[model samples]
Target: MQNNEELKLALLIASIAMLMMAFFVISFVMYYQKKRFEEEKKISDIEKNYNRLLLDTALNSEETERRRIAQDLHDDIGTMLSLTKLSLNQLSKMIGTTGDEKEDQIMKKSQSLVEETILHVRRITRDLVPTTLERFGLLEAIEEFIDKLEEDNNLVISFQANTEEFPRQGQKLELTLYRIMQELVNNAIKHASCSRIEISLESTEEMIGLRVTDNGVGFDPEKIKENNLAGLGLLGIESRLAIVNGTVQYEKPLNGGSSAFAQIPVMPIAENKPEPLHPFRRERVNI
Candidate 1:
């Protein structure tokens, strides 16, 4: 009887030990999972904050650009037009019942000024938003932009479109994509000092790709992330891509230049979808 009691006690102790071991193993797993979740949450929060900052920067930059353009129109082109009108009004008062040679000369000069002002207004409007992109399509708009750039100087831009038609990514996507290319071209002109630029548009089953290659000194992606003075262009590109669910890759070739490749994923446009409300929409706010 004593032996049987001892045997039973030993078995019970062993079982209790196994049970404690199992409990500890489960507790450790739970703790590990909780820790992992916390870490992931922190990462997610960081991303959200970064994106928020990017959006704010983009919006502010856009507002500044718009204001500058508006001021140019009001102060420069608008002033010229107003002066032309004043000149015509003064000339009309000087006109007598008979034609004068001096009057004819003044009229011709005023007409020339009017023509010059019209051309300037058209150029400014085109720069603000290309009418070709809206009316004709992206391809034509790009070609026109490149032609204008080439006309200005040695900024030789070679453009090729692999597809005949652009993917149906909605108007907003089209405009955003155009703006991205526009910004890239301006950056290449102002900062890169690139003489030769090659642009290619390609479409795949998954996404649309835009590649701009410039024969100029390359830039460091790290410097862009660090927000250096020379990296504002890259920063703008980053902000644009973030908003559009796009990706950008920058590479430097052995020939000593930079290449920028941007890819935008194809998203299906929902039918009869309501327009998204802008979060920062306001009637007027004094800055």
Candidate 2:
């Protein structure tokens, strides 16, 4: 009887020990899973924040540099060029040679050089800051731009305006659209064999659409995809649209030409929450 009782006790002890071991193993596994999940989550959040900061900083820095360069050209270089032209005029008047063709030639050369300088400075300023876009909203500026492109590039640029006003898109979106149009027109002039190109804009309640069509010797999308990537002009347009949460499609239209279309978000983008305003925060540049 005593031996049987001891055997039963030992069996109970063994069972309890096994149960405790199982419980410990399960607890360890649960802990490891939780820790792994937390680690991954932390990594993901860090990457997301890093990307946001990088994009914002890049855009902001670009704007700052543009403003600075435009101001310098307009305020400093423009004034000097004008003053130099005036000085040349005064000198020509003082050195009055009685109808000397040689003097006239020198004066003409100076005048031409001065004109070129002024024109170049103006061009640089316009490129840096589209004063028209700021003053006359987007539609009028676009029309004016097309007119300039016609005179400057000698390319038959056609633009059809579907909307007279686009108030909801705000200045940022309008600027992007204007810049993209400028880029497309430039690309057409440089690469597209066709002289005529078409630009159209349509807007609905939900989104805005832009179409750029060229009657050029259209290249296959698959074969020339490498060229498109290498130039980065196409990639640049893609990136800009992406910032505004837009989509771009490249195709050949029924008229036997290449067409690129973009649709962008019209509604306001969601605002991100600012990082915690801690007392220890410093003017530390993010590397």
Q: Identify the candidate with maximal TM-score.
A: 2
* Per-residue alpha-carbon lDDT of candidate 1 for residues 130-177, written as tens digits (9 for 90 to 100): 557656667888999999889877878999989888655554455567
Model 1 stretches with alpha carbons more than 4 Å out: 1-22, 31-115, 220-230, 270-287
Candidate 1 displacement at residue 19 in angstroms: 4.7
Compute each candidate's TM-score over C-alphas: 0.69, 0.75
Off by over 4 Å in 2: 1-49, 97-99, 224-230, 269-287
For each candidate, how many residue pairs have backbone atoms clashing (under 3 Å)? Answer: 0, 0
Model 2, residue 153: distance off in Å is: 2.4
- Lowest summed lDDT window (length 10), candidate 2: 278-287
